[model samples]
Target chain A: DAGITQSPRHKVTETGTPVTLRCHQTENHRYMYWYRQDPGHGLRLIHYSYGVKDTDKGEVSDGYSVSRSKTEDFLLTLESATSSQTSVYFCAISESKRLVGEQFFGPGTRLTVL
Target chain B: AQTVTQSQPEMSVQEAETVTLSCTYDTSESNYYLFWYKQPPSRQMILVIRQEAYKQQNATENRFSVNFQKAAKSFSLKISDSQLGDTAMYFCAFGRGTGNQFYFGTGTSLTVIP
Candidate 1:
């Protein structure tokens, strides 16, 4: 509810195609994260950005990539999407690095890869 | 890697009654943080409560409180007065003080029936 928005609330695409998800924040937070949620798997981190041009891979980053050219925008791209990548993706932002655990999330984007 | 565990897959409580959700975590570091997040059907992740490792006193927010046992590495959430709106998927998270990553549990689906 902290001015975070995830585009493409729902998308269905064929496997082996490229896909991109966008996360925009109006608060200009210093930290941004992308997570994927699946049944019985809760949520797993895909990638995160500490600042502009500063990114890091998370536990489940093998099929995902991220970019942050500005403080308010973070992008997650899936190159040659696979059926395993179908899940609900969420975007979160935090104001302080010291309080990274406390994040504000946007409405998730549900993606289905066939 | 830090791990969070929520053994209970589903819980139900009557409206206006009290309920508790169990959460246990494993971490190698002495100092770390614990958190409870709520994911409604809308798929937005909301922070329910937080507990600091260094603090002995439990943290409370309105009808929500946490019983944090640092020695046992247990952090449970107590909802004093449950409501229908409280029905959601609750996730336990672990955040190491030195790392920016947050490890999440599989989640517990809570149902508050009136």
Candidate 2:
């Protein structure tokens, strides 16, 4: 397993409340990503960071935002939580820019928005 | 944009038997990569196997192998001598050589019966 950890392994928040999930890595990988997993949607990228302070939006980034101030950490925040955002969130890291490089994943965080 | 599709939502197989999971993808890029990931009840995502689009030979790992047909845009996983630990949700993913994001399929839940 990779030395990756996601804080607040399980969280329950009410609608319209602000929430943030943290992903920390010890591998010092150059790339980090955030993804949401749902019943019918296996996994949809929320955001990704190529380097410190360099980030890009993904397919389902409408309700989510992210920040990467340091190499070891990537954060995902929801300004106002929504029930539709209740799902399992995963963090992944890759050592190289090549697509063939294996991406290591964190255990995941289960968030429930009421 | 690239899309990965897993037609089988659920599959069952007896322990020690062989089972195959189907996956198909659509992409305009010629150079890319494909992967299969396993998520157990513990909610941890594990990389099963990987195949490079430019390679003509398929990739194999231990008891797991991938039948990658580049022209057909198909990448299927074959598990031999399956065990109970193999029971999990399997996902097919696509990644472009020059891109950072990955596109994943809905997933196929596999149950290894005793």
Candidate 3:
């Protein structure tokens, strides 16, 4: 266990509705990452944070935003959810940006946008 | 940009048998890392094993092992004595020692039949 938890493990919302997913960790790790898993595409990075208030976009960042104001919490928000945006979101944490060690993952959140 | 590829979309093995999942990647960096992750029906991503590109020796974790062919940019996972619990989706990932992003391959769904 990496001491990670994702809230609202399952959700269903209509298109154009704003949605937020929360990832909380107790490990006090320095780096946190958000990824979306979809069939035929594996997992794609959405965003990542190296430190509190420090963030960057990943391969697939369109229509998504992230916030990390504290060491233990990273939040992902969909400004306007779309059917195409439905996916299983995962949160991962590492001790450093280099990731010399393996990353620890949280149980994923499944979101469905109609 | 780096990319990882898992050519097998699905694989099956009888209990107590061994199974190998193939993964290939494209990268110009000589120093990096490779990982195999397992996601069960519960939707939790669990690290099965990891290998550093600089290490000539393969990495092993209990029943899980990796055949890391650095020259060929291939990282294949070998699961020995497969069990019913091993049924899951397996993903291969690549990361540089100094970078924050992890490039993932489309997963292979593995079934361990009794």
**How do the predictions measure up, each by TM-score?**
0.96, 0.98, 0.97
Pick by TM-score: 1 or 2, better one: 2
Each predicted complex: what DockQ? Answer: 0.65, 0.76, 0.74
> Which stretches of model 2 miss by more than 4 angstroms?
none
Interface RMSD of each: 1.8, 1.3, 1.5
Candidate 2: the clashing residue pairs are: none
Clashing residue pairs for model 1:
none
Worst 10 residues of 2 chain A by lDDT: A94-103
The candidate that wins on lDDT is 2
Measured with C-alpha atoms, the lDDT of residue A39 in candidate 3 is 98
Q: 2 or 3: which has the higher DockQ?
A: 2
- Residue-pair clashes per candidate, as listed? 0, 0, 0
Q: Is model 2 an incorrect, acceptable, medium or high docking prediction?
A: medium
The top-ranked prediction according to DockQ is: 2
| Model 1 chain B worst lDDT window (10 residues) | B94-103
